[model samples]
Target: MRCPSRARRTRALLSALIVSVFAVFCGGEIASAQQEPSAPQPVSAVQLQSAIAKLGDLDYSARTNASRLVRRTPAAQAVPALIQAVSEHGDGYVRYRALVLLSGFNDPRAKDSMRESLTSPNDRLRAVAYSFFEHNPDRALIPQFVTAFDTEQGEFVRPAVARALAAAAAGDGVEVAAARQALIRDVARGEDFFRSSVIEALGDYKAAFALDAITSVAKLDGPLQDDAALALGKIGDKRALETLAAIQRTASRQTQPSIAAAICLLGVNCSSHESYLVETLKFTDRNAGYQELLRAAATGLGALGVAGHQEAAASLFDVGIPATEDSTRAPVALAVATIALRSTRLMMTLLEQYADREKAVALLAEGFDMLEEDLDKERFFAVARRTYWESDGASPRRVLMQTLIGTLDF
Candidate 1:
């Protein structure tokens, strides 16, 4: 070949120089030339400060964008700055937004900030703090919440405090007796504001010791009665089941569905009502009232365990798989999943019968998503895999299997 041109030689020299510089800076390991460069590390502190500052921007869009950005910050570095923003820098709405973002982080430091907010002169801040504790309850904070509820003078904050106390009390390792006494005292004080929440917490804690008290509430007429009945169902004690049955037997049309649902969820004998549940799925009018009934009945059937009820499964598949409406589709899919968990064979049968495998798989996926226990989820996945393999990668079924495999990884 002829001697390389001067331009080519110069280009070669510059390329070698760049590679050497890169190797020197990057610990002498030559990076892959084909690979894309890594993204720049977020300047956590600067980003946090900038986002906090934008919370007060006059434009609503700017404020919302800032809130979103602040929420995306690294929790480890953002907690301190967010606490400062909530405590010192922001107006009522800004502080509220900051506190909301702070709640997403599972940092112990955020607790102290929340506790401090309880004493702030601003009612809105106090309310937000209580709401945080309500949804993110801690077992260790039960006493503090109880004490706060007693001393909190503002009417607006009292309900929030009660809700927080209930949530905290529901946690394991809580002083159950003391928490129950506190809740009962408030209930007896006749403040209806937090009575339902307290009942819910009592059930959540499975405070079997409070069965008698909860039953007493369940006997009362009105909204509290329904709350108490649901709480009793959640408690799942023999007495609670009997109490729910009693409510179901005597409840008016308006209240019967809820009590029935409670009974089903408690794993009580709901065989007598199974027919009605199946019937609820058959209504095709799509009226709002019928939709609500469909959802409640479908969910109740799932809670009752749909393993042997081929009829129920058929009804759910008929309504749910083809359901274009979200309201009807969600409940029906959930019911199907619940049943499938108990009997994977039934789900496979339904899948085999349905002409549209993609829609069927999507529906099953929705149901699978509702499962909370890891073991149950894994079992569902195993069943789906078996179905996939048994079909020998056939069309329609193959599509379902592929979608299921993809979703499982996610």
Candidate 2:
């Protein structure tokens, strides 16, 4: 399976081209030289072909370049080079990139090479291999795809395989039933990656049976419960609505947010529990914004198709309690506030809370300087209006601006 010297070098050359191109694009002002060091360099295609023949000069940077080209280009000629780089190269990440690129090629030769990598001794490589298979959902490869699907320990791979299987199952595939069963198995176990992937795939396939899987996970613990709750909302097979109602009743307060989020996201109008959402916030001692929790709740309430969902927002206290950890806090604050603001009642509550909490209050006041959207400006203003802005010192406003933004969107 190792690539030949010639092919290996081609991959390296491809890598060099990519780096050069990126440098040229990124540092255009700097690279705009009056002359090339006032002298012409001597590099020819024949020498490049020879230099590329050797893999010794290739490194991860080069491999990265090769992978990107494989994804974008129409050249079938690059397939063999990429296949060798992935199969015989250093590290599974590089191999994974190669597999992704290989999927684009229509030739059986490359497809066969990709299939062979499905059994890569390295689990990372196997994970990438399955991703390609899942993305394609080719029935002819299901048996081979399944081998990796079942035994692969990599959570990363499982989601993609489940997705591919779910995608493929609805078609005239040999393993349509098996794919359905696998979806059940993953959801039932509360496996985080598989559960979400299956639920999402069900959305793509419109698999009503998949709702059972979502319901099953709603019963499990940890992330799947969260995922299952979201999936149920996404699927919107009304048959599961009764199950959703049941789960809403018995599930922990921790689970409520997800359930609410799911209902909201699905746009289903079945939420008789609108009062319950209002009631739930009062009882729960959770002070900080629970993101997954709020998302599940707001999204589910949205799904309930109830106009009164404005109540859920009113219950949100408009003034968001930011998590001490800015990473976790900001996104949750924005999302829940956005969902809650859908209702004027909720928006009023949020505005009131902003007026109430002093430090958190000040943060919302200055949020607009950093925030671009009118929606964010509105959310922050709602918080600012609810909480009193007491200026403590010069840094009071500065402290607020610091949390309002991050180096990047989390």
User: In model 1, what lDDT does residue 189 have?
Assistant: 57
Instruction: Give lDDT tens digits, candidate 2, residues 1-410.
Output: 00001122223234434544654776722211111011113344443223223323355334433332333333345556666766676655555545555544444666666567766776655655555555455787666555656776664456556656766777554577676777666655654445555665565456666776567767766555655665676566666667667787887776776566565545554354555554443333254555434334433333332234444543443323533433233332333433332333443344344544444433332222222222223233323322212323344443332223221110
> Cα lDDT of all candidates, in order?
0.60, 0.47
**Candidate 2: what lDDT?**
0.47
Q: Candidate 1, residues 1-410: lDDT per residue as tens digits?
A: 00111122223234434544654776854212121112112456777788888877886456755654554456667788888888888477678667766765557787887888878888767877777666566667677777776787775567567656766665355474566678877654555545655665565445666688878877767656655675676567876776777777776554555577566556665555666666656663255666545655665455444434565566676677766765676666666765666566766666667676566666665655443322234345544544554664446665555565553331
In lDDT terms, how accurate is model 1? 0.60
Per-residue error (Å), model 1, residue 177: 3.5
How many clashes would you count in candidate 2? 43
